[model samples]
Target: MASFEVIGGRKLSGEITPQGAKNEALQVICAVLLTEEPVTITNIPDIVDVQKLIQLLSEMGVTVTREDEETYTFEARNINLEYLESKQFVNLGRAIRGSVMIMGPMLARFGMCKLPKPGGDKIGRRRMDTHFIGLEKLGAKFKYDSSDEFFHINANGRLKGTYMLLDEASVTGTANIVMGAVMAEGLTTIYNAACEPYVQQLCRMLNRMGAKISGIGSNLLTIEGVEKLGGTTHKLLPDMIEIGSFIGMAAMTGSEITIKNCQIQELGLIPDTFRQLGIKMEFRGDDIYIPTQENYTIETYIDGSILTIADQIWPGFTPDLLSIALVVATQAKGTVLIHQKMFESRLFFVDKLIDMGAQIILCDPHRATVIGHNKQVSLRGIRMTSPDIRAGVALLIAALSADGKSVIDNVEQIDRGYQKIDQRLNALGAQITRI
Candidate 1:
């Protein structure tokens, strides 16, 4: 288990560019399996989860060439479908939730695929029903092996297009269904689809590769099944989660930092959500410049009530950043409620922050009330363990702004999502040592 040894109370400055979106990279990289042609992708984040997915694909016999650190060309001309039955495949597939995505493309093209119960952050119960159900609507059959916890999915000939109103607008579920529907025989309409930038990028990339998809940025997507898809080059957007984390770090530590090339428009409600926490930021071109602030006050609702920031679908506050908001609010001037609707266990990390002297009330499994100290009191760092990726970075931010040293164990959780996080923050003057 890797750990981060951080000395807090040091203000950092300088510019840091966000990595290519991890969420987007996972989706599009799996889309390569839908075609035999070479799919070149740039801006892939060099991280553990992404690497695990790429290695999984390679073991499945997808020819992967690394053009650069962030660019890869994947040719799925001769995928080894037999590998799916191997115990080795199960070990690799169980390491990342993104491994579930390969099912759609593999089944769409090769007509069969198997997956072990996928693994990711233990935030809460992440259901795979949405993925399986949506694909079932497109004429796929699924069977579960209770003994091995593997899903066996097979398409009945070529998938026939149909309409599906998703139970939820799950990003991965929607991406999976879209990939499965792209090569079906007729028109497929997906209502209540995820319209996040990552999903939109996947749809656009499919279009570029000869698939016909409409509704590039809306919940209602229509896909006219093409006979086949071809090769295309795609670039991933900057990770909004990382960008939000950087914003929180800047405010918490009273530092001035510029986040460059942030693809500001695609960030949706992220900026305003942070603004609601009283963190001030300026948009200089495509860069976000956060100035040093000794104090920033949380905003009240329109009726002068305490502010409540809840996570919702796209165009709403992202559930992923609620931890960052909670951490940033620790030093803000007013009170706020963070409702983490998507994951029940995400707020459990607050007990660690409370140990460091932040006043936070864990209302329940999904909500917390934070009483900001307004920087009148600095958090005293202590030893802690990272429970998940977002919570890990949130703890790191808290440690950075604390008065003393802190040790964060299981930092591999953070590295799964954030690429070279300690090194990147260190370049901007943070004292984070990997031990």
Candidate 2:
């Protein structure tokens, strides 16, 4: 129900630090359920989705102590396993997609867990098959109830590890399976696992907690089951999606903004992908400095073909930032194609951009060709609605660069990912007001 009233055409200049990774926070927070010892986590992003997950864990008797605004210590020594069957738990679980991850640790330690259908963005159909299939490989049985839309999962005894070849490289699925395998009877090998920086961080943290996990940053993961795991402190990397969004915002609004503590090395191919879009950025230590620019041109292929930017697996451009790249291309000097291969409905938000006077051709559900105005045609601000998290931020960036004022409703979607985005951007001279 919240909205953002953004006044466009204002140049922003200041330094903003990206928040901790949202994806990583969800995974590591759920990993706390694997051990009864206290797990201290710092640099946690205070976003809506993460807060919901923390609340869920606390309600399950996980003894969550807030050390500070960005730090917490979780001890799951007295978990109330019976809470899983309550309507309150189901309501809370279905509200956020991250709640599904707790099932892995629950079944691994407590022998049983139940989950309602998880809810998240309506971008596309996100299946739980990968998670179930991987868990089943380690001696787990699952039953689905169509009447109540609940999933019942149980293991007769301690999980027995085995090898699994995932049908897809799903990040959350891989994290769940790895958590289930960490305390199994034998070794577990996972192929085609998602090797994003988030997953790598989880694996490293697991190893720190006395779990034998190798292949930290590759598609193949090897896990040697241990009888138990202990607590360890973990810190999250800066959110690369937010860093990419900031770079796009700077290019579109002719702003000179420096993003601090970006963990640039873990942001694989993100900087280079934005560079291909002609957004100039400098890497100063761990910070990214994007200078003011009136115009930036899109780069074409060597043989004069129109450049196509598509989302692929890790080490490739992330699908989460494709919307920002598409928006940035609207004001660039040349044409570029944005291929959103991961989600079919993600590119549908271009209709809002079109209403703002950007020249974009929605080729299909999966592709869009943006013909840049090169700042020749100033976009006129208008009222809009945020469809999802990434697209919401993309629209907000467009509104910041438009000629007049714009109101974006349903900003809760944006808050699910970005941490106080309006306040952070407003600190950098952006006129974004929460209404």
Candidate 3:
């Protein structure tokens, strides 16, 4: 385990660039298996999760070439089916949640695939029923191995596409089904599909490779099956979650920071959601500028009631940023309820903030009440342990603005999602040492 010792109360003034979106990179890297030709992707984030996925590809026999620090070409001409059944595959797949998506391309191209129970942050009951149900609707058979705890999916022949109404708008589930449906035998209509920018980018990249997908940014998606897909170039958008984290970081620390090349168009409703939390931002030529501020006030409804910040599916405030919002609200000038409806355990990290002298009420597993300090007093730092990727970054932000030395353990969780986070923040005048 790695830990970060942070000396707080430093005013960081500079510019920072958001890394390539991690979720988008996860989806696109798996799509490379949909074709034998070389697929090149640029602006890939060098985070642990992405690197693990790349390693999984190499283990499965994809020819991965590093073109540069931020670019890679992947060619899956000869996939090792034998490796798919080995313990190495199961161990590798069990290390990350995104590995479950391999079933889609595997069934699309090879008509069969198997995977062990994938692992990820235990934020909530992230059900795989949606993935299995959607894939089964596409004419695939599923079998579970009790001893091995592995899932086996097979199609007698090429999959026959059809209509599927997902029980929930699952992002990874939608991506998996879309990849499988692209090379199926007929047309596929997916209602109640996830229309997140990550999903839209996946569809666009597939379309660039000859997949026919309609309704790129809508909930209802229609995909016409094709015989094959060709390789093409794709660039990932800047990470919106990271951008949101930076916004929260700047606000909490009273730092004047510029976030560069943030694909402002793809980020729908995120800026406004932060604005509701009283973060003032400027749109400066594709960048987001946040000047230093002594205080910011939370906005209330027209009825003059306490504001409620909640997370929903895409086109709504993302659940990933709810933790960030909760942290930012701790320093604002009003009271707001942070509702994390999607994940039950995500709000539990607020207890640690309470130990650091924050005014937070853990109402329940899914909701928290934060009473802002109003910049009259600063937060006192303490030692803490990070629980997950998003929560770890929130704690890091809290530590940056705290009044004393703070040590964060389990920082590997932070590294899994963020690309060189300590170095990036250090460049902005933050004192963080990794040990």
Candidate 4:
């Protein structure tokens, strides 16, 4: 239902603006159904899976116009497509795993799309078989009813692009096969593609509405088959896993925080994986700052070994921020090992950080280890619950570096992806109440 409580050893400071980019606004709000002209988008991250895919594109009519709380203006001219063979878009498209990327722009503009069975963040077997094997290798035709689970898909006439190769590298299956190879008709070579900046800002908003992609940020994508696709404004790109969970909640509450407008070079390798758990980042121009330190040590591997951190694919190191780098390596100073090679249950929430005293070691469903305790025994708060969405904001950054109160029941799985996250960590002072 609703719970947060928090309170812990607080220390927070100021600047915090990293919203907009819930996985690139669900692949740029399904690239506004591949354009019917009028796609305004902006720093949109009023989360809940991007407002349930903009309320399922206004229940499939698409014209969503807001322009304020983080802007919007979609306008898929007049789409209803029988509400994608409704049961109410299959119960609002099974609560968003990016609503299966609206079957790649509704099978590239209404060649039939009807999906269901989608939902997100169980953190495990998330496989729409590479989004229907790259939209059935761009010719589309993937049935799977199961008496009404639904995933029908079709491409009745025009959809010809070719060359695929993607077995993995599926950021929403290469953004639903680059929104069905940008209105497929000709060239489309996607090979192992998933160059995420949310698929390079959905290939630069489908090349400013006129698709022709071309190896953006690498992994080889090259769309170029446009017959239609118009409106464009796009702007999202800040949430590098909520700026690596506010640089791991300002190094597990030593807090000096300064995040603000953080586009700091698309945060590759997430500030060197939290400086290999030593914290202290500084970028300034486009802000990252994060200072307030005391200890933070953990760096090893030049041969010394014992320093794992893992999670590759996209300048590597973002398996949704390795659960805020394993809760900022449990107050770093020593061990590391996160691993989490593409989810198994997202390290089973580190047994609620080893029941709140923190010394982790699950080392199973995709590795864990942690073991820092450098704050030397502070974490004490308990009653946790949140299961998914990056381990519920990594158990709300280990309940804001625990020490006292810490309720956190579900919290709607961190508000389906943090946006008003306890009112922006209560303006950087953070007590987080949201009950």
Predicted candidate 1 versus true structure: per-residue lDDT over 1-435, tens digit per residue: 899999999999999999999999999999999999999999999999999999999999999999999999999999888898898999999999999999889878988889999999999999989999999999999999999999999996998899999999999999999999999989999999999999999999999999999997999999999989999999999999999999999999999999999999999999999999998999999999999998999999899999999999997888999999999999999999999998888899999999999999999999999999999999998999999999999999999999889999999999999999999999999999999
Which ten contiguous residues of candidate 4 have the minimum total lDDT? 119-128
Tens-digit lDDT string for candidate 4 (1-435)? 889899889899988788888888888888888777888888898878889889988989998989898998988888978878777788888988788888888888877787889888787887679888788878889889899888788999777899989889878888888888888999989988888777888888888888888889898888878889898898888788888888888888998978888877887878887887888888889988988997889899999888988899988887888888888888887988888887788788788788888888786899878888889888888888888878888888888889899898988988988877888788778888887
- Candidates in order: C-alpha RMSD to true structure: 0.6, 0.7, 0.6, 18.2
Which portions of model 4 miss their true places by more than 4 Å? 1-3, 7-47, 61-78, 81-107, 110-173, 195-302, 305-311, 314-317, 326-328, 331-371, 379-392, 395-397, 406-413, 418-434
Q: Can you give the lDDT of residue 318 in candidate 2?
A: 96
Clashes of 2: 0
TM-score of candidate 1 versus the correct structure, residues matched by position: 0.99
lDDT of 3 by residue, 133-233 (tens): 98899989999999999998998889988998999999999999999999999999999999999999999999999999999999999999999999999
TM-scores for all candidates?
Answer: 0.99, 0.99, 0.99, 0.36
Model 2 lowest lDDT segment of ten: 103-112
Task: In angstroms, give how far residue 123 of model 3 lies from its true place.
Answer: 0.5
TM-score of 3: 0.99
lDDT of each: 0.95, 0.95, 0.95, 0.84
